[model samples]
Target: MKRKSTLSRSTTETEISLSLNLDGSGIAQINTGVGFFDHMLTLFTKHGKFDLTIDAHGDEADNHHAIEDIGILLGKAFYDALGDKAGINRYAFQFTPMDEALCRTCVDISGRSYLVFDVPLTREFIGDFETEMLEEFFIAFTSNSKMTLHVASLYGKNNHHIVEGIFKSLGRTLKDACSIAAGNTEIPSTKGIIE
Candidate 1:
């Protein structure tokens, strides 16, 4: 079964179009106006081994709307692609290190949505992209996707490394969570249903 989805989201603040393929070779074509955010998305796709495409237009002066909306759209794409969540691992975790930064991410593809983010950046801005927006993005994603996510930066002196590690770890965890096991016809839950 091919797991893929395309989404178009438009609001008074932004317009976003995105495509995702769960089984892919980590190819990404992204243009989100915010360079740093785009870089993070690229890393996410690459590390997750997923093919992704995104085109977004939003309030350039204030990037929070665009970033958060993109997260929402991306989350919707993941949920739609997964369909009934049959035969999937449904849970995953990863720890990644970049230079002095160490980050961990855990994901559960549950029907309920929750997020616990404990990343502290050393700086406030990464090339005009406010670091605080990262949390907002993840909040939007988890809430819309109905997935539980936990992200933490264990140790990091550099802001870029910390953020990059988190994104990369998130990608890897999602990849594992979404993978289907051989001969596993049932959902990976004891309750017999996921969401």
Candidate 2:
């Protein structure tokens, strides 16, 4: 069966829609009114090899709401698509490098929400995207998805490279964590259920 989900949410701050497919070939179309943010999400989907589409609009007065809301919607989409999390690897970790930057990310779809981020960008901004919002996005994502995620940037001088490395590593890690193992159609947890 195709593992897919579509989610939508609206508030005074933003309106968003998200669609995701766990088993797909890294195709993504995203628009959040933040160009750099959209680029990062595209890279995420491409690296993860997951099919995703997002449409988001928010009060441009502050990009924070739009970015965070997108994260929440995307996380919800993943949770909805995974259903009971049966027959999945359920854990993944990866260390990736982008030029001078080295980043690592780990994930567990354990029906528990946690985010540990240890990245510090040398620069204050990456284009129009505030460097700080990256944390906000991940925080929103992990909280909504109920997944344990840890991201660390071992070393990086450039903020852009550092952020890119983290996002790509995260995508790859999540992809591995959500993959279905052969001949295993039951939840991988010893509890016989993820929740």
* Candidate 1 clashing pairs, residues 3+ apart or interchain: none
Sum up the clashes in candidate 2: 1
Model 2: lowest-lDDT 10 consecutive positions: 121-130
Per-residue accuracy of model 2 over 1-195 as CA lDDT, tens digit each: 679999899999999988999899999999999888998999899999999999999996878899989989988888888999988899999999999999999999999999999998766678888788889999999998999999999998888888888889988998999999787898888899997
What lDDT, from 0 to 1, does candidate 1 have?
A: 0.93
Candidate 2: misplaced stretches above 4 Å? none
How would you encode candidate 1's per-residue C-alpha lDDT over 113-172 as one tens digit per residue?
999999877677999688999999999999988999999999989999999999899999
TM, every model:
0.97, 0.97
Q: What are the lDDT scores of the predictions, listed in order?
A: 0.93, 0.90
Off by over 4 Å in 1: none
Q: Which candidate number maximizes lDDT? A: 1
Per candidate, the number of residue pairs that clash is 0, 1
lDDT of 2: 0.90
